[model samples]
Target: MKSWRDSVRNVVPYTPGEQPKEDGVIKLNTNENPYPPSPKVLEAMKEITNLRKYPDPAVSDLTEALSSYYRIDSSEVFVGVGSDDVLAIAFLTFFNSDVPVFFPDITYSFYDVWADLFQIPFERKPLNEKFEICAQDYYGENGGVIFPNPNAPTGALLELETVRDILDHNREVLVIVDEAYIDFGGESALSLIHDYDNLLVVQTYSKSRSLAGLRIGYAMGNRELIKAMSDVKYSFNSYTMNEPSIVMGTAAIKDEEYFQDTRNKIIKTREWFQEELRELGFSFADSKANFVFAAHESIPARELFEAAKKEKIYVRYFDKPRINNYLRISIGTDEEMQALVRFFKSMMNK
Candidate 1:
């Protein structure tokens, strides 16, 4: 008789950025917004009084809020626990073909994990030398395509024309644009939703709206695609979102002024930080996201990563190939960035 353990499924998990428990550390490992959620979100959370009842399984209120904010119909929006949850469901719903799905080799690491977990075949199309996605590479045959705009770690933004070029080629299969950081400085693929039925644009409040703690994420696409994902979600979990999250997420979407203010602050800080890094002999692509992927001319990234941690400053360092020498640093507040720059200056002086 075979043991129960032998029947268990096992796969490598996606390792997330470290969350240090201690206080007084400048945490920037995960690409989380350093600011608090909108005032409206806090106010709305105060109204979530009924803890006894189940939150709406459909997540209608939050869904409607996103729809209004994006100017799409509610039927074209699907809400989830986070973009991670939403993208996982998308991978499961689509990518059913025998051919391997395609995405950037250096994109959000979770894409490969989700594909592996779902037992789906996938191929990683390598980004160019500059860490930019090559549109022609994705023109070939595959199961489906998904990549982030202003992609992760590298923080390089693909223009809308390039996005359309890829979509134009792969109209037969679903193309998912993971826009988790679109609000930073990238033009969104949301405008192409009506032009291409196969397109699904996923965005989250975590980065731009400071709601990572609430785990609010959503996808906007054609009504048909939205229905398919919603159907799969309901089949899997009826109430993926709780009452507080639903109310708070709705409030976050409604506060457009606060959202814009915070997003601009992050972008400004990111630009300033990049200039500082360059002055310190660092090289990186011009980033449009909230973070910068940089490599020093002489110092190894691991050394800098350790040195920064010792000073109570945290940033993301990927030990993967190609990017092994690079560090992805998130943009914090003005004072936080100044301190980071000062730390770098001290390291150089040594």
Candidate 2:
């Protein structure tokens, strides 16, 4: 039993949200777009008849598409399998020092996994009682820094000026602002990439573009950081993206109007859903992401999660310290969310 796994790889891996298989299940546990991907994306995927060849190692089409969309240089863009893959590559390429990287203790659950898997030293800075990252806590000397823009699970967004403060303070190390949920309403720190060489903004097609199945993500930063990540990517796996994903992701980005419509619809649904939750006696942060971090006044989060599951409605509940009472409910379609609200009401009435 004392093999390679026992000595160096002994750690708890990140647990993703449940992906229920039963039909008609209101799947809202994961922060995936409830809408189908753009019609253009599907059409583009259908055109890829040549599946035998390897995808472009450079990922040229997708990279150029991202650069064009963001109005940044092609040299500043780096694409990968997903934001998770991009962030992992960044961890491997940049966070190589004795000093510990810093991130919010309650943000994306995967941050710690990447740091630990890469054997990089890191510290989890606690969010305040409101589950907000205190920008001052990230001021002092550290290794690299990374955090979700709207901050995950909690869905509380840190403002741009405050992000600038962290960037200003940590000039010596890389600062990554994971904007996975920014399209939900939060301001991106991407514009600051022009002023700061140390800033790298990682984004994904999963949330905003309704292309999670395509599994494409990219980063924008100074040419140096992009080059470094690109080098690591090529050495590790040149074909990080498949032909279908590359073409489909580009098509998804190209249909900007549809993208905005879906994003806005989700935002509107979230606003309506928040008010409904408040009326049902649940308290939550002012979420700017596609999900709500909520806890009922009297009901335990575990009980609520189980009740939702029994009703064929799956929502995320993190049974962790300090956040055990809260559930992270992803915004589903209007009908799906209404069903969830009705289920909650029935439980409360009982």
Single out the weakest 10-residue window by summed lDDT for candidate 2: 1-10
Which RMSD does model 2 reach against the true structure? 1.3
lDDT of 2 at 280: 95
Superposing all C-alpha atoms, what RMSD in Å does each candidate have to the true structure? 0.9, 1.3
Candidate 2, residues 1-350, lDDT tens digits: the string is 57776667667799888887779899999899999998998889788999899988999998998899889999999999989999999999999999999999998999999888889999999999989999989987799999999999899999999999999999999999999999999999999998999999999998988888889889999999999999998899888799989889888889989989999999999999999999999999999999999999999999999988988999999988989999999998999999999999999993
For model 1, what is the alpha-carbon lDDT of residue 187?
A: 98
Backbone steric clashes in candidate 2, count: 0
Number of backbone collisions per candidate: 0, 0
Over the stretch 1-350, how does candidate 1's per-residue lDDT look in tens digits? 77999978889999988889999999888888989988888899789899899888988888888888788999999999899999999999998999999999998989999998999999999999999999999999999999999899799999999999999999899999999999999999999999999999999978888888989889999999999998999999999899999988888888888888998999889988898889999999999999999999999999999999999999999889889999999888989889999999999993
**Candidate 1: residue pairs that collide:** none
| Model 2 segments more than 4 A misplaced | 1-8
